[model samples]
Target: MRTLSRECGVTDADNPWLSRPVAPQPSAPAYTGAPTARPTGPSAPQRGVPAPDRAALLPTIDQRQDADLWWLGAHGGAGETSLAALIPGWPAAGHGWPRTPGAAPARVVVTARSSMSGLRAAQTSATQWAAGLVPHVQVLGLVLIADAPGRLPRPLREFAQVVAGGFARTWTLPWIEAWRLGEPPALTAAPREVRRLVDELSALLRPGADGTAN
Candidate 1:
């Protein structure tokens, strides 16, 4: 199977540059203004040394995190992609998740319920999770309560399964349960409960502190 990175044009399927890894050599010391005399010795014969590839020297990031939640927002418009712009104090650089601010440990909070939301969620999570610098994060999705919000859409079905069980008609509160049990919560119910859910999830993500249930 073609890797998603290749499909998305993020990487080349047959990239010759990535064939071998190259270690970076230490930077040469700066030269002082004084000039040195050239040595009067025979030149050594050049041997077979492979040319270094620039791309091969770059770092590869693989996803490694126990807690990452993706929430799908309503279809169309900015969708969940807007999440990149919304986090407080996050810098507007890089294609993946924003870097954590140095002032204080922080958490990312995105809310949406659309298939696109999943893609956007990944975009936001990649930076922190890939670097393994951020703490476990809870992805909370406030699925809009449609009168006939059919079976969880394919994009959200997986997450709903994790948090909402398979029954489409039921109202599962995985986030709430997690909050109550000191686990990071990932999904919550209707409008009335969103603020509280986010607050609880935020607290749970806070360093040196565990969330409390009512």
Candidate 2:
């Protein structure tokens, strides 16, 4: 059978200008976009990567810590940092399951770049989560950060749809030049999409949330 990449005709030649991975970086500008694909349930057999030792990944946060959410990067440079910074109350875990002994499972949102490697890393994380390989965390959704300043390639978009099946929901962000230049994003100053995202995340993050998609 033809693979999604092959089906969509995505090849290495399509992504010739790849760069190093990093964490979250939100933008202060406006962008109405292809924000997400509703969950289609987890795809276990195809394109899933085996999970890692999650216990070793946790660094242990104090129970007294005030934060209520964690941004887990699916890979390095997935924009977990910027999203964490976007909401002052959240923190980013550099591609790990954030667990503290004696505490309830921490809430998390996985992030990745729109590039093939980034989204594949996200797929791996989501598949592992669905397979119960990741522990001590409730995944909120997947967030795909733009790797560049243009529309996503057709193949990547289609492949992203396949990856989105593993999570409760997913959100995508456009490439912000200001963020690339080291500018910070503010909820009050951000565009409508950012505001909407903040609102949705805030509601799901409230106490008693079961991490269900809105």
Candidate 3:
């Protein structure tokens, strides 16, 4: 795995926010257990923010089960919906954090494209989360969806490096041609990297698994 801190000269000695990368561990079984629920109550809305449509909320795969993590989009068309459907978890989709009165996972993963603007939005969200501006949600890391197929341009790659440097961990998903055509993702049809990412994330949600939290 390519770590941005090492490549960008962001040692812990120079930057307090940067830390040593955790080594990847062996795979574990995927967790199919339901997430625990938390206390439910009416949440007061922020003064200026408009209330999101609760009716439009994406239906959870199992209403009885809670989510292991909440996926939030860093910007529009950041593949949040697709990923939420592809991956096993609750998707916030640019709306605020999950506020449904139940046990919800505090861990959050933000998604964005590999483009400059997407990276900037992701960086800002990560920065805000790191500074504790986003209450109740702990940003696990970033998930960058490739803007296109093949290698990225030098400028975009450099920008991604800088953005990745700001977070302890980041996962990059390659462009999927089938997805653009509106096909559902299947494990057997996914790329090796995509499978690896899913396995890593699954390990994280399972108890006693050797998954690292960034």
Write down the lDDT of every candidate, Cα atoms only.
Answer: 0.28, 0.62, 0.58
Model 2: lDDT of residue 13: 44
Candidates 1 and 2 compared: the better one by lDDT is 2
- lDDT by residue for model 1 (126-170), tens: 222322333332222223322123455564654433322111111
lDDT of 3 by residue, 1-214 (tens): 1243353343444443432012442323355443322112111112222222334222222223345666778778887777766554444544444443454435667788998888877766654554344455555667899988999999888878677655546789899898889998666687876676666666565665433332
Report the C-alpha lDDT of model 2 over 164-194, residue by residue, as the tens digit.
Answer: 6556677788887777888886666666665
**Local error of candidate 3 at residue 160 (angstroms):** 0.9
Q: What is the lDDT of residue 45 in candidate 1?
A: 13
**Higher-scoring candidate on TM-score, 1 or 2:** 2
TM-score of each: 0.30, 0.69, 0.66
Instruction: List the candidate numbers ranked by TM-score, top first.
Output: 2, 3, 1
Q: Which residue pairs come into collision in candidate 3?
A: 37-103, 38-102, 38-103, 40-101
Q: List the lowest-lDDT window of 10 residues for candidate 1.
A: 37-46
